[model samples]
Target: MGTTDVVLTDTSPYGSRMVTVEYEGASSVAYLRGAGGGIHGAVWLANHGQAPSSVDLDRLGRGQAPVMPRAHTRIPEGTPPFTSAELEVLWFEEGDGAALYRNGDLLAVIPGWADLERGMPGYARDAVGESPFAWSLEEALEGLAPRIAKARSYWEWRHGDGAWRSFQQFAMSHLDTRVGPPGRYWDIGGETLPTVGITERPLDEYTVLSTVGMSCQRMPTVEQYIDRPDAYARVELAVATRHEPAEAAQLFLWLARYPWHSITWLGHGHTARWYGDAAGFPLGRSYAGVLMLDTVPGLPDMSGFAFGGDEVRWLWLIPLTDHELQIAAERGHDSLGLSLPGRIP
Candidate 1:
């Protein structure tokens, strides 16, 4: 798309002198300068529902008004910090489970099937008549401890044998090394925090065309995904030591809609384009947000080492359209009150 640039002059509380705003199709890039001629903050606007016009630029340059086209929850300052030590559980359509990661280390993954069987000993006998079940962090950890012990023993046996050593050897070695003493291993706390519930329904009508395991063909580029007709969305869930759950939700919404540039150190590479809307269902915990993109293409499977860990993990999800989500919410499938853009729930 061709770009257009406009310069406006205005004075403001911050002593702004001139602001140059450029519009390129659905995106806008702006640079603010102070009266003293020093460059201020640079802002890039995209997927914000409306493209900024020359008149909008003129108003912004003059500081006459704000150009927010949609209502957004302001991310408060001094938000809580997100550390890698907290456990995060992601429930996808393929399987329901909790992935336990502590300080960038993969502790264990307890599948929902296993959780159900263990949580309710008579689940098999009552499988036909059992009601839906809800899993909690405490239950996840309860199942996780034995799994961790089994993993540690397996790693110790395999590593000590020295017959199956590989580049991945160090990761397992660290697992054993990190377990300092018994009864103090794997930081399972006694309290339970607020848990965020996630519900996923299949989009059987739409199929995401992308690369999969060992395919030599290049994966679809982000631009290709953007050009596709199918509606898509992204939901990001994160946990950390310190940070307000709401603040993280707001940040996730902002990142999904805005074409913000960031550096991520995980998987094989870190270059990614985050474009969409700043509206999403907030997973009520520390640093967890879900972004749902509409009418966009599906994203290719990407992997990275989050929290500077050796375990490479693939990140992928299927985003539901507003209509689909609304239907689900109306059916009372999700109690979290998941809503679409411009929706107040």
Candidate 2:
């Protein structure tokens, strides 16, 4: 939580400086480099299972930039480009590896001690690149793709087109009217990219907007944290509203990357507060948050269906006022009953 200056700083041949900063009780090396008149830095956590090797210390001593000391990966080529905001580069203790994600979907994983240690200096020597941090999102994806593919063959749950069809059949089975586009028609920034889909349907009273692609990827760490993780790890969100379908769709965009972006899970009786000013919410100022549930009295139950061999849960999004949100937090979302109480209705 806090840092103390311990090891003296060493400068790189490239003019970057590496300093040992003690975080909590662990020593992490902070790499600071001058870029475009500003100094930017990244920390390599000490808990990554290996310390800087002698070659690293020797290179730093010789005023040469060491092979990248942090754990990282290269993803396969032809993989979709991830938006800068959605990309996550993580170092994991279990794999002794680094995992890359774009909007919660795993892109690649690279082993820390072997592949990165031996391969990175080759990258530096060839003038290819030093770190994912050093490149733009597109450039990073492009550069890392082949290297990651070569190091390890990667596969994800949502690997094929067949899974989408499987989900569509399950979803349409519960709906009163099966007429609607198969996938999302609009693009909104900050939403999950290439891995999630939204479909809008017009009904007699309210328009229904549902996320189709959410269940495709399993929520990370769900198995460790939740009971019956198989049933809960895969979830999709929906909203039924009298407002324009476009307006209701904004709510999905806000939440599309939430579970993985936050490194958590969502399930029945969960609540998420609006990210910004309540007034800025698509449903308007009165609704300050959302309460997720598997059932709503007047709506069809779209849950309990299997997709990609995993049970998918469809959670209805009920917008709530600050007072209602507080009540749900204290008493539980079940106390709110099955209904939409916001002005958007």
Candidate 3:
């Protein structure tokens, strides 16, 4: 059966939301409530958090763009009303995009407005376009609701790890195992992986955390290369000085092409087998394959190594001496497939 996603209220200011969602297969924040949209600001947080929107009214008043600097986790104890003239939204439609007023006014929607359009979904709040932290640990629980809502099965619900977990706890205090997906993988390692169990997810939810790439799916701020991430455009513009973005983007693309190669399973079957093969091959054989295990104990076998494709090919074609295979076995698996480069849909 397919995994189920369950949705429930998650309310809390200082903790993770404990949403009861099902089908939390992986522990990446990619499964977290709004880790994709909230941390990344793709879907917008105005509709998620207590406050109506994330627009900086002050900036709007100044005639400057009201780019929100950061997402406010909580509604200030004493704040203005939900109604605000400065409220604006940005989103794409049919063949174009627009930055409309939150209520009904269409502010400005023009070509090349992906930045403003993204902010309409709430990604624009980072006035500066990127965050400096590896991750925005102080995320709002409410923003992640859509993620769990969409991912959980009819019988399950998912929760967040940091502030999200706390929110889930507030919603139902605790969860009913058979009723729906448990809120968080409490006490698990810092991962957002699935829980293991018939009535429960196999992996621990509590300990799981989101990575930059995974976080990128939800919020642009969560980056894999940058602990504190920046917007794609920002990084693209800053590539010369900080080439990490370009490099990371390349890695992301490479990963997309070889998804089965993800070391998410804690290094197991495919890992030992594949790496074993690669290691067995002649010294320098650039062989690659998917280590299908969730995560192998000896996963990430290519620690501190890059794909020396040309060199590996030359080494493999030359053939390994007996001592070489023996030495390779001692290291780890190294299964290589004839990686025919292709494009990802």
Error in Å for residue 72 of model 3: 20
lDDT agreement of model 2 with the native? 0.52
Off by over 4 Å in 3: 1-39, 42-191, 195-286, 289-345
* Alpha-carbon runs more than 4 Å astray in model 1: 1-148, 151-302, 306-321, 324-345
True-vs-predicted CA distance for residue 182, candidate 3, Å = 30
Model 1 weakest 10-residue run by lDDT: 209-218
Positional deviation of residue 176's Cα in model 1 after best superposition, in angstroms: 26
lDDT tens string, model 1, 191-286? 221111211111223211111110100111222233421111121222111223233333333332122111111111122222333243332222
Pick out the ten consecutive residues of candidate 2 with the lowest summed lDDT. Answer: 120-129
| Candidate 2 per-residue C-alpha lDDT over 306-325 given as tens digits, one digit per residue, 9 for 90 to 100 | 65457888888888889889
Each candidate's TM vs. the true structure? Answer: 0.18, 0.52, 0.20
- Clash totals in order: 19, 3, 99
Which scores greater on TM-score, model 1 or model 2? 2
